[model samples]
Target: MRLPSTAHTSRPWRIHGIAPDFRVEDVWALPTPGGPDDLPHLVGQFTEGEEPGMAGSSFAYRTLFAVRRRLGRLLHLDDADGGVGGRVASLRDRLPADLLAAPRGPDSDALPFRSVYLLHDEWAAELANRTVHAVLHLGWVPDGAGGYRGQMAVLVKPNGLLGAAYLLGIKPFRYVVVYPGLLRSIGRRWQETAGRRK
Candidate 1:
């Protein structure tokens, strides 16, 4: 479910340190509730595209990704020349010594994102393009019952007026279509996978 910005900012997340300049675009409570050690398993599933909501399965979810890609191509939004190291700097460059030494699991092939860092309870990935530079963060939060649950937040540094406008335009679609499908799919996948592990 969508949450208030404070839900993300109130947490003492390391992401805040590196992305102070960016805005917390969105925060969500994922359905994948589990124990502490379950985070890596969740992250692994995400990286492998095992989550059904991400790629396809649902018409709405698939269509959203398709439209975004087409728009990106048409507008040259995700062009390499206008992406990280060109239009904007990479967030990885700002990592502290300890974070720099931390594990960077893997780069995302489907999403134009690069691994930033991976911690025991959190993982972050970054993407930069013409419209905005963004970070996708996944965190493990204790559930107060000797377990944990997944939390996700999106951080974005819009490039200029265009970036801001683009985000504004997509906000409704994200809320009504994109996010709902994503959460539902992830939840179903989590149940399927978790069942197997048990």
Candidate 2:
């Protein structure tokens, strides 16, 4: 699904005060074997010793680039440009043809995948809480040593505030399994980063 433009003009969301009121069920991941790893480690590293959490924000941005590198390797996409935009273009080109050809559905059983980001406002909550958004990026990859790799990122913004992005990469697998726990772990890392902002 199309996401709110990542432009600076968008109103900043409020992250402080009340905890964000968002559901965990809405989060989803690409169906892949072995799912994502190092989630707790990532969160701990991000939250360790940081006062406000700016370190986590920096880590998220830097981590995205690292993920782009791994994605290039899995997809066999060249990263001569060595930038996020270039990496995404390469990934789009490498998606398995079958996934692109199949119709969209919850049970397509297809390996290739697409992603969506969900957003919710206080209208759905009791406290008139801050606007909350979740970024979900999903796609399929090979399995086993030879299988493809799938990767996705879930970013949350509270009260119109945007900070601390979270991402998870799935190893190659025949059947993809979306994990809610992993998403929550990622969201927490993002929150740590958001908390650090000045």
Candidate 3:
């Protein structure tokens, strides 16, 4: 999806020091196309609610919570009574603390932001070894401004070394570029969804 040029022209969001206060409400492993060892792999969402907006103003908090629940189930192999909780916990620990911070309101003292950490490490080396392409979509419910709603999707195709380095914390600069695009895509998707619903 192409984003609005105006959105691109503006200043981008930045993540300085990690948020001192944050919690991992949930996590899960994304399913590979075939089995557990597929090359193009993905992990589940670490946070529980909506993502940040393009203009850095608003978001859909509840929908993200619901998505995490559903992703949790999918990663659990549909066995609600099984090891899902453990899997989520394990993955949650690997995420950056800021990514797990509580969602802030548009006017709150906190900055409006959201993030996901994708890793291709020794534990899941197969994913890191391949040329993987990934995209994350976050549903949003715009605060007020009528019944309009939307979604934000971040698509990434990190080269093998860069991708692996990102997961390892050896390279953090790439996120600076990646996140703004994510915010923009999310805002556009939310706007389109809201327009269609009306």
Candidate 4:
């Protein structure tokens, strides 16, 4: 479910230290509820399939993704020179000594995002292109019940006016189509995995 910005901002996330300049674009409460020790398992949920994210089994999302990719290609939005370590620095460069030494999360071949760090309760990945530099922050948090559930927040630092405009243009689509469909897929996947374990 979509959450208020305070849901993410109120937490004392390590992300605040490094990407203070970035703005929180969206926050969501994920459906994967579990015990305290199950936080790390959330990573496996996303990485299990050939496609690494919420595009699975959703024709609308798949179509939108394809359209965006085609647009990106034609516009040179994702060219190597416009990506991480090119247009903007990787968040990894800003990591503190201890986190730098800890286990970074797995990298995905299908996704442009690269894992920044994997903490006991939080995980972060980043992607940058000509349009913007963005972070995908996932955390395990109390669900107001005894169990814990995954939460997601997207943070972004726009490149310029064009980037800002692009984000603005997509706000309706993100809320109406992208996030709702994605969250539903995530919920279904979480349930399927839980069922398999029984």
Query: What CA RMSD would you report for each candidate?
Result: 1.7, 20.3, 17.1, 1.7
On residues 27-92, what C-alpha lDDT tens digit does candidate 4 reach at each position?
A: 999988887866666776655565534546577777878899999999999999999999988999
lDDT of 4: 0.86
**Which residue ranges in model 4 land beyond 4 Å of their true spot?**
52-56, 195-198
Q: Report the C-alpha lDDT of model 2 over 1-198, residue by residue, as the tens digit.
A: 112233111323221112133322122332333323323223232224432122334444445445755865775443334322332222223334543453222211111122211112100111111122332333332335654323343333333321112122232110122233343444555445433432
Best by lDDT: 4
Model 3 clash pairs are 60-141, 149-194, 150-190, 151-189, 151-190, 152-186
lDDT of 1 by residue, 69-134 (tens): 898999888899888888878888999999999998676555577789999988998888888899
lDDT of 3 by residue, 20-125 (tens): 1221111212111122221112111112233333234323433443464486466542242322232222223444565446332122112112233322211110
Candidate topping TM-score: 4
Task: Return whichever of 2 and 3 wins on TM-score.
Answer: 3
Worst 10 residues of 3 by lDDT: 120-129
List per-prediction Cα lDDT, in the order shown: 0.84, 0.30, 0.29, 0.86
Better-scoring candidate (lDDT), 2 or 4: 4
Q: How would you order the candidates by lDDT, starting with the best? A: 4, 1, 2, 3
- Superposition error at 192 for model 4 (Å): 1.1
| Candidate 3 runs further than 4 Å off | 5-95, 101-129, 139-145, 160-198
Q: Against the true structure, candidate 2 has what lDDT?
A: 0.30
